[model samples]
Target: MPSTNRRCPTVAAPPQPTDPTSRKLLGRLSLPERRFVADALRAETVGGVLLLVAAVAALIWANTPPLAESYQAVRDFHIGPAALGLDLSIQHWAADGLLAIFFFVAGIELKRELVAGDLRDPKAAALPVIAALCGMVAPAGVYALVNVFGSGSMDGWAVPTATDIAFALAVLAVIGTSLPSALRAFLLTLAVVDDLFAIVVIAVFFTSRIDFLAFGGAVAGLVLFWFLLRRGVRGWYVYVPLALVIWGLMYNSGVHATIAGVAMGLMLRCTRGEGEERSPGERIEHLVRPVSAGLAVPLFALFAAGVSLSDESIGQVFTRPETLGVVLGLVVGKTVGIFGGTWLAARFTKAELNDDLAWPDVFAVASLAGIGFTVSLLIGELAFADDPVLTDEVKAAVLIGSLIAAVGACVLLKLRDRKYRALTEAEERDEDLDGIPDIYEEHTPEYHLRMARIHEEKAAEHRRRAEAAAGSRIEGDRPA
Candidate 1:
């Protein structure tokens, strides 16, 4: 008789969805995290509206003759070690010192992607990776072409590489019904990848002179941070101390302190699912949410969004290749590059087209993806501070590009409304599908109304106009 040993089989846990929803049960967040998440989500859906509101406020303050001084005073308001002992400039602090938090949040998101989000599966991420590469390359190529022989031209290559998440999300929110969630998800993945690429480029290509000793300290701090992370220390307690050290070291390292921001973000991992996408909020991301969303981003917007428009502003932008390239790259190049890249990629890869998205819809989305506000502006200062002319051009380009993307998204979404309306009509006709939830109910008011109502209103309006015309004709024929 032989003695046989059998191992017990472990049952696999329930499979999560391809993209798990984050409206999950969290024990509780700090009061700030709760308010911050609430506001950040609102910002994503309405950042454009917020931008519009802010712009209007600025316009009223800047143009209303009496309030102009207040507007100028606000821009001139300066702070930092200048009042205390350092050469770090105002723009530098806003972009480098403050926006580090944005990078930290972005890094958490990137970690989530690699671990469980869209990039969870190599195959799943392939589509976005390819699309993102194309998206980045095409715009840079287009920008370069636009600046072939122009001044400040060399710096223009990076213009089309950035995708403002706020504006992109705003477009998705406004487009509510026209575009699919899948499309929005796809765009977000591509943008994140693109941002990662841009960050790398900045770290490698855009830094000032290197301070070897300080850089060594920064690198050591990063190594220590990585080790702490690997030890499964997920608390802000560990990260905060190291973040301060790394940031201080990196500032002296001459590698651009913003790189430290990205370093902090990328080095850490976020809680996500396997073979499924997850949100950073699922983990300790709640802890950092307030600092990133509530404090950093709005402040970045407040400081960076301001563009002093003078009589020479328009002229200055056109003359500088850097400005022209950024504007053109973001606006024209973004549309062409995104649409062309997507179309070409789809052709070669034979990727399954998401339902209801035709070339026109694709074009609209591509156009929308070109909006390069926050990151673009941040880079502008980093790339061309010596040349204010170039910065102005970037500012102009960002404003225009973002506007184009937002408006384009709205238009395509309106076009998409027809299909949604039709689908709603079809769904309503089926009596057996009683419990089918209307995910799109929040939008589609016009769709919710019966088709007959639309026709009836149009017909009545036509009849009223026709009768008025007939009466006018009768008067003209009589004696006039």
Candidate 2:
């Protein structure tokens, strides 16, 4: 039997360092990471567009005179079985239940990055990790500073700490068409770390009390989940019901139910077995990502983003310190923290920005990171759950801040895009003069031979069609 193992073309060797000690930040990706980033960007781009539409619809629904009351009524309507303590408002269901799927997908991504992707290397992971941490810290600090002397409570500090991967990717996909793939990879890595931190903050800082028995049950279920995956359990029927049970237990335990999703996701195997095309984690992520992006996240955004944009509400967003803090944290703090942290890492460590990118590119991407819509809204709601007025104010701030960031990133990235576009055109012109197709220029001899074989096959098909037509005409005169 022949061996089926093959090296993927996308996974090329990293460029050798000119200096032994110096490392490149946002370097070329391995095959799996490249494929993952491509797929994720595609999904998140569509998801981000839908999320924007849903948010806009929500705002219009909430602020319109005739539909405002109806919107509130629908969001507040109760559903779910009460016997198992699952009853919750429609809005809560979107938040606690649908968002779990989103986090579950996130967990799978995190696991893959940690195990098989760039995050596996300590040196490679350092830049994004440091940047993500600083990104979170700076926003929280800004929020705290604003709320300390102001009338608003400081509970909403974590609200601005999140970077919405979907929205950020969407913005990048739009404005950075000619930008380096390294920028997307950097943003994806930074967002993954940012998500992990956000989950931890939600679990630790937000939970008021824990029901020990329920918490224990949730842990036990997680163990069973890991055990089943280890044993090569394959059926969704078995895992789906079990996952629900775990989610319910986690919710009842006063910890965030989304944590259950993340736990299960982290436990799934990410490394492929011998002769396998993809790992179990990758398979599951592929199946669930569409559901999470298309349905779960959009639904969550629809329910969460409905804030009144009345003059009074708009006034409160600017006047209230906590709300104003959220605005500044997302716009100014995210920009400064990410760019500053990256600069610090490059300056102090052996790491340097990739040759394909520059300080301005990093700055633009950092600005794009400030579009903290989905998770920021979730944290805002959790922070100000008791204060509806404050929650609305925070939601408004998130929207306004994200909008500002989006616009700023658009302007910056557009300029970068034009520059890169001109560079690409110049390179293409040179390639054309060399008599080699640009696509085949960097391809290996093996790849060129394969493509040659494909072309020969097409030529053979054309000859066969011609022969068949000639034969048909000869027969037509004799038999017709």
Candidate 3:
């Protein structure tokens, strides 16, 4: 009785070290995140195309002999209540007011990502976040190096540090049909983080003078905004006026007014409450994103991208140190930073590249990240506000750099897409011969029923053919 022994319970083996899912970068996204990303991509793609058109129109208008004066006059015209210190030029209104809307949408997406999307997980967040940081830093470094050795102002370093998500995604959507979904997700995340950093750079580096009273008022308004939303207060009439006041205060405060939009967007509740169909953030984002994409952004591009395309201006892009720096920083630095950073993180940290992606896919996306159109132009404007000539040159450089990146990315993405398409076709063929594809394997019963119906029809056709053949033979034998 004293010698009784107890049997131990079995323990399942831990997942193998070689398991593909562990620590992978750009892993499968949740259904909601996937849908959100897809919708955002579609809108951004359209917006990007519109932005491109506007930019082209602006360039043409600016370069034309008769239209150039009219374009300049229109952009320079002032409107807004002077009592509120808001009498800004049409160009300034586009840059400050409309871009705030764009930033607002970005803030909502960033908040959602932090609260519920991939960024919620530190492991999942590391790759894109790191890559984005490196992407920004490398570009700035390149710009700095160029300016240090040449006769150019260093103020435009941050210009090349920004990546325009809309343009990059637009190019990808056009060419990456058969490419991995993970690549799109990776690019989106990288761009979002890139935007956050760009916002910080703008606020920190670009401020003119301190209007502490107005700045304090803006902060108080932000606090009130957070308080109201937390109290479940709802109404466009209430928040709209408050937001406009805040934006005005922020604009008057000498800090970039776009910061106000992002702040309010971040404060909005992201998680859905009970009995709610969507979160306040989601609903507001749904309403505002279309405006930001379709109206705000394109208008901003129209005003911002109207640089002269004359031979002299074109020559300045390559000859001027600041403009040349922007070009190299975007085309060369972004690619090296993102791709090299990914490799480093995967090698040193627990992170691993997703099995569905190769280094080439990452390289392609990195090249796409160099499309620093929208924010780059904004930064260039701020950097050279005193020098119209320099600003024009910088804008031209941004366009040229972005074009080169887009073309390079297109070539690379096309190759990757072709490879992926071939592989997909092979898989479809194998699946057809071997039974239901893995995607339909979940609907096993329905698939089985469908296959059963198909087999039965085939069998029925064979039976009819056999009966006809026998009848023919019998008829021949009897009639002869």
Candidate 4:
């Protein structure tokens, strides 16, 4: 205890971390970083919900007269240098740039799924991926077929192919547990694949002719980043600088700058817990949650969902090919295609139908999948931004489609819920112990008698063995 008297090594003081939430507010942080993490999660949830509300409000505001003009003026406000300056153009920056973060979050989610969750098992993942592929390809084809002959509107063919995760989740929450767990898992998986497809579409089809010099610069930055990664550079430092250069260069290179969102997520070497620690998936999820929910998604919603509705616009929206096509494709097409595709995949392929989900329940789940609001809005903006009229019409279509899809899912789920309730009660009351399973049936009198006879025979054999052992002991004693 008196090490001070000896020339022993001096003990070092504990390191102090800056920006410690608990230290400032709640005193010493609890082990496992409980004090900060829980607050962050809660804050993210509140922020996400608030952002959704804000987006909806912006939509309302954008539809108003003088307010809409003011909003547009503010959106057009420039940031950055004079000649090198960038104007948000419209309410598009918040949606495009901020929503990039949302997409980055989506990328994180995809990574987590690949490492674990439903994507962990390849056999299980096959059906959802197939269903998603069909759902995407079919809708796009339908849109393309309707708009063939090199029509100017052909750019929006991918509009309806999206599945909005938030809108879908909202529908499912109302629907409750009448739907099978497997069906929900499938729906989630499919949406992720749809996101991947959307990213490709943006990168390949949407981008204009590339500026090779700027592209080359961007490539150089990425290569430099690769070396930095090898050198153990922190993500915040590397990605912050990396993102500015990439997005900026991509913007000049005739590529939609938002592609940088997904690219950044892909580059980060996802870190996990150390020896006997939690998974990297959990950590990445933690990091992604706030940025995506609190900031990126809300900002996107505000920007993308802004549409000024008037009598003229309403009349035009009904006739706009871009408008009608997206509405029909998402609302009508998604419901039928998802349900039908999944059913066929289960029957024809190695996948099984969700055993607990009746046909009615599957129908409900399919309806929920039709809520393509967010991604639909995003793609529509990218697809037809130069044509404001089409963009306005698309905004209306997505709103309508999301509403109809949500309503249909709610109604179908109600009916399915009643059916499951009746079936469950019937099974519970049945005398055959939970619907006549052999495990329960095997408890019958005849089965017990058969078992009892076998047990008696075995007891008799044990007694005979004991007698034989006693004889052996007696024989040995006599000989001795």
Tell me the TM-score of each prediction against the true structure: 0.72, 0.86, 0.87, 0.72
lDDT (CA) for every model shown?
Answer: 0.64, 0.85, 0.84, 0.64
Report the number of backbone clashes for model 1: 1
Evaluated with TM-score, which candidate comes out highest? Answer: 3
**Where does model 4 exceed 4 Å of error?**
1-48, 82-85, 145-152, 173-180, 270-276, 279-281, 418-480
Model 4 over residues 137-173: C-alpha lDDT tens digits? Answer: 7677666765663253778888888887665654444
Give the CA lDDT, 0 to 100, for residue 211 in model 1: 87
Model 3 TM-score relative to the real fold: 0.87
Task: For candidate 3, write residues 350-408 as lDDT tens digits.
Answer: 67665545688889889989999989999999999999988989999999999999999
Predict model 4's lDDT versus the native.
Answer: 0.64
Better of 3 and 4 by lDDT: 3
